[model samples]
Target: MGVGDVSKRILLGRKLRSAQLGETLLPKRIALPVFASDALSSVAYAPDEVFIMLSLAGASYYVWSWKIAIAVAIVMAAVIASYRQTVHAYPSGGGDYEVAQVNLGKTAGTTVASALLVDYILTVAVSISSAAQYAASAVGWLQGHEALFASAMVLLLTASNLRGIRESGSFFAWPTYAFMFAILGMCLFGFFQLVAGTLPDVESADLVISPAPEYEGAVTTLGLLFLLARAFSSGCAALTGVEAISNGVPAFKRPKSRNAATTLLLLGMIAITMMVSIIVLAKKMGLRYVDPREFDRMTYFDGAPLPEDYDQHAVIAQIARAVFLDFSPGFYFVVTVTGIILVLAANTAFNGFPVLGSILAKDGYAPRALGSRGDRLAYSNGILFLAGMAIVLIIAFDAEVTKLIQLYIVGVFISFNLSQLGMIKHWTRELTTERDPDRRGKIYRSRVINAVGLSFTSVVLVVVLITKFLAGAWITILAMLFFFAVMRAIKGHYDKVQLELAADEDDKVLPTRVHAVVLVSKIHKPTLRALAFAKASRPNVLEGIYVATDPVETNRLIDAWDERNLGVPLKVLHSPYRELVRPILQYVAEIRKSNPRGVVAVYIPEYVVGRWWEQLLHNQTALRLKGRLLFSPGVMVTSVPYQLRSSEIAREREEREDFRVRPGDLRRGQVDERRDPGRRG
Candidate 1:
């Protein structure tokens, strides 16, 4: 093992074998938080977004806050009911993409997949950015550095997820539960105060909202309807993580579908309850909020402008401050948990995206590397890719949740509408084929449920498109289109390669003969080894080839070769330009072009160095020659490694690290794995 391997082992912990994959599967207790945090955490910001959208028309529109919340809750319920059918019907964990593909068509499936992929990336960005804002608000030192803070959070999440699902789930489960309890407790206490007719006003309740510039005059009916639609669409952020459970059904333990469906139910109930409670409580307490950027929109009741430095707290912060005025710890605890849950909310996307990527890879829609599990039985490549993309977005937007939020939920609702439609198709097809009346009746019911889901989601998707397309949602659509094109291109390339690589009778035929050529730059040990290896192959003809650019050096090599009386003949290909790879490639190409039926075996000796930096000093020519020769027709390139004295350093380090690197390991059929722990290398 090298230093990198040692560091990876330390960072990701001990590796787990493929057989231990079952251990990584989560029970319902753990699955709920691991997959539901994204939706649940939306309570911290979704209501605020709704209030922000409504505040555009002034606080007069605040009366519609709870109404929009109820509307969102209804949509979420329909989605949950629809996904319950999905979990029961297509529980292989492809989620919406699988449902859409199997029931609708390839194009529809690809579109849904592209949408979900972009949404998952945005989920990480939005959640981590929101968390960074909360952290900055709590810790003054963290201000003005949320972009770097969010990026660091992304890296940490990537590392944790690379360790395997069960480990990360266990680590994140508590914080999610704490968030749930703290938020519910705060809401319940707020309600209790409301019922007692003693609810305190929020910190910003005394402030008045100035109507947006466009709405400062008499607002038409169309304009009011548009404002309400925007608020509803913004509140729909609560539904972002709902489909994650369906996509992650396979990650659940025994009775996976049932556990997943149950988890979905719990997520929907909790998220909707919390979201509605927050909105209703905010209204009851007269929480006044406007765009933080438009500070002029907020003023005192006397029509005086609020101070420039007036800190407008978040909806949750205002609610917590109002509800826990006497007990400071309660306010701090709720605030702390909200921030923590926002960070953990991104874990839902981390889990969903990798599983979806793995499925896409298996279907040839993504790179095959995504389908391969790492030493820890996790989709490490997908995790790393998601982290990198999310970091790019975080840095690009400067970790501003408000800015990133504009690009959110559009992808999710697109998938939602498609998935629900796909489910309706799925159950209808089942009704046609399913003979048992009981199952058919169940299918009819599920079809109706999916139809209801489709109707609700379709409306939400349209609202989102109309309300947000100009407000950054266009970027999300463009990203989805880009992913769709890339996935199709990938699948097309894979299909082409698959067809070309499939074995035929012609592929089994052996070469007529083998002409071995050893690449010799000097009479050194590496060159000698290459010559010996080439001779041992017992080819039809063998020769030592050299590129000669200087007459004196060529004569010296010819005289030395004659003095050594070596049996093999030396052929020098003179290059006037002193080019190494081009001359050798031309020589091999001529031989291969002449004898198309025979194989020209080019053995290039390379130095195996212990240290990574030492590699740059050696094997430059051999690397280039092998790279070119391997691509030529009727040519086979073999690497003959000459171990240097410093290579003992690698051997000793690997030995101490319980790793072994045998020369010609592949040719000797050595499997790279551990004996005791059974790790796959």
Candidate 2:
């Protein structure tokens, strides 16, 4: 049909009927990876973070690494348990926002939403940056171009997601499972080697780490606690994506809550296992890692710095190298899966953010377009927005995981704490209403679980704030605030518009008189058609108005009108400055003022062409005039479309096409089979 329609058809491909949306429902196999990649991919950088923080007191602080991991694990468990209850109780897919709104209040719900939105965006930025780091380590050419590589990865992920959730899930599923296997496989093998007393230490084992300038000296008791707290906070990155499953419960097949709960349990187990294994292996292999800035402390024999260009592999990379030294394939497998999983990890945010955005949109907090689905049954706008934000962050941070990681986990923990508190309130209210003994007991138990979760997450949130805020977490807090203000502003705008445009008691009262004005650019077929249409309305007053921009054209139109004897009077609006819209608008305003109780109807003759470029050439002034008239009170604007011969070709081509997929239709899985629903045979 039109160029816009053709481009859209090409971009989205053949559209499936909305009824076929059921086919896009994910099975467990695909759902696990689609939802779990974010938390699972955390293992790639979580250990590095823990080690970096511990490097403050050198390798001696390493022993506390495992303890910090345990603290993070406990918090992770609490959050998972809490969200499992959320999935069961609020399976409508509102996740924390709905829970907080219903149990807490609108303000608390909006706060959680703000936090989660920031977190989801950070998830994409951090994951892509981490993947870029891994890629740099794997390929020398990607080292200095980390930002570029990271941006490309984001684009690739966006394209994959644009294909719809089901298709993208299937595409990313293997890498997630492969990552699970690779990490687990490496850990198991490393453990056996340790048991056999044959485990070779990592290449960095013999290297020494120099403490930061601030932490130099004997570690005081207070200093050690602070260091451990910071390390624990860093390790809490592992828990960043735990709430995503709760946010995405509706994505699962039938029995959505049960499947979502099971997925949460599975995610927790796998994430905990992989995280602990990596930490344990790093310790056993004597992995000595430091912040990239202080990395000079690591040296080879002869007290010389390692190659200036030497790729300092990640903790998992080093451990994989040592454990699979004799097994090259296994090492490559681990590296490949780790990199892929890191990139795919953003899918967790992609899946969660759109669903959350949809909920917000439906609740009048976001643009209404995001509330609908795209042809592929995906939230395309939400996905693109997330990708765009991530790319901006990636470029700004130069795709450095360490810097981006500092901005991670803060928003999620805030959401986690708020969600748990909401759940506690929810259960308390349920207990009051329930009269059945068995159900009441179950609710009471759930309350206890939620209480424990709230306590744990509250502590973690505080620790994260205290430890990481100065280390760059304040950026994330600022981001949350920014998102909160934006969402509120959008809601306010929508509300204000709704109130202003809403029909009132006076709307039913008929106007005292109707005055019709036909806008004529040329006395041609289009103008004739518009004049005929305007005359049919039988207004109390009818006149043809034209801006006298050109005297020659004005004279020609007057002569033509007189020759045709159209009977309608012609009014000339003089504009020496050649301001078309302003003059016409002023004329309409004067007319309306002359008869306050009369309605002025402006009929604009619009050229309807097949090509988009043709539209640009024609109707430029008419469009702007119509837009201005819409905002004017007592002024009704109508477009009298005059379709040209070219429009027929476009209409025929559209009729021949089988279907079309529009934006937002993919999310809801709706497909338009007909070219135009209003078109008749």
lDDT of 2: 0.88
Per-residue lDDT over 221-315 for candidate 1, one digit per residue giving the tens place of the 0 to 100 score: 99999999999999999999999999999999989999999999999889988999999999999999988899898899999998876788899
Q: With candidate 2 superimposed using the best TM-score fit, by how many Å does residue 239's alpha carbon deviate from the native?
A: 0.5
**Candidate 2 error regions (>4 Å):** 1-11, 300-302, 659-681
TM-score for each candidate, following the candidate numbering: 0.94, 0.95
Give the lDDT of residue 674 in candidate 1.
Answer: 32
* Overall lDDT per candidate, in order of appearance: 0.91, 0.88
What are the clashing pairs of model 1? Answer: none
* lDDT (tens digit, per residue) of candidate 2 on 267-307: 99999999988998898899888888766766765678877
Best by TM-score: 2
Whole-structure CA lDDT of model 1 = 0.91
